[model samples]
Target: MGGGADDADCGDAENKLGCILSYNSHVELCVVNYTMLAVSLVAAGGLLEAERRLDPSRFGRKFVWQAAAFMAVAAFQITLCFVVNCSGVSIIWNAVVAFNSITVPGDTPRHFLFMYLLAFAMALSLDVYYAFTLELLTTIAHLCSLLLGGLGGFMYLRAFPNYGRQLRRPLLGAWNGDGGGGADDDEDDGSTNSSTGSV
Candidate 1:
């Protein structure tokens, strides 16, 4: 009797597993995943919109620029996975880090962004390992946001020259000229020309 009961329990477990595998059940998990994914995507979109309205000069400040790139990386990965069923999130994340290392040196915001990406990627790996539907989907979405945000930030930075420095150059030249009596020469020449014409 005990053996028969054990066999029945095993059979029930197998049936439940089959139902989950078929995707006809576990509606709650699916709903949660879908909801989180939608929210993540929408949030990224909002950031992109706000980024467009901001002045390009702001990106040169370091933190804001790198943060934008980070967001872009997250967005790209998530969108790729969601739309194209990508499974290479790790590869893309590493590539971003590598790009940063190669292109930007010193203790910069990109390093900080690297740390952040590393942490998020680890969390995503754990979610996948445990077969967590909502958690996995959320991680993917977050990744996409980071990816896309970084790209948007980079684009914004590229849209303008170093406006702050460019603006300063002319001002600095004018100040130097004034200090050297360059303005006085112009006035003196003008006065001499007027006197000659009058005579």
Candidate 2:
């Protein structure tokens, strides 16, 4: 009977340890994700600014500037990730500690959700800007890029399936390829040609 009690105590201790370890791991991942998201946001902003300053007629030059901005952002994000790794702290812990401690008054989850939605909104806005400036081929490429990022975000949000549902609708339109305006315009021209048969 004494041995049974000892075994039960040991089991409880083991479970507690496992829980602590899991929580720590979760925290570290949160930190890394948050950092990456933050860096990406900065990069998106730079790209937007560059896009805004670009001459509309200078498509080639504009693409070059945009690409340069993207490279710069990618470099910064990579460097930040490397620095976090070198600091001997788990990136997950960075996320866990920051988010838990940084809550607004009244409702933590709601505030965090709003923050995420705002990030999504910014990304979507960038996508719209890209769509407007890029040629059809480039626009499709950029859309694909956004889609992949959205997929990754969705997977992350999936861990909190209930909360993830709230984010589902706003992100849906982000993946939609450029509107069919170009196609419609082309169709109109083709029909006109067929009707006239000379021009």
TM-score for each of the candidates = 0.26, 0.27
Residue-wise C-alpha lDDT for candidate 2, range 142-164, written one tens digit per residue: 44444434443344334333332
Off by over 4 Å in 2: 1-108, 153-199
Error of 1 at 7 (Å): 28
User: What does candidate 2 score on TM?
Assistant: 0.27
State the lDDT of candidate 1 residue by residue for 1-199, as single tens digits.
0011112122234343333222224444335334433433333333333223232335345445555665665555445434433322332343343333222211112323344334445434534543443335445544454454455435544654432222222323433433223334445755886989842
| Whole-model Cα lDDT of every candidate shown, in order | 0.38, 0.35
For residue 41, model 1's alpha carbon misses the true position, in angstroms, by 22
Question: Residue 179 error for model 2, in Å?
Answer: 36
Best by lDDT: 1
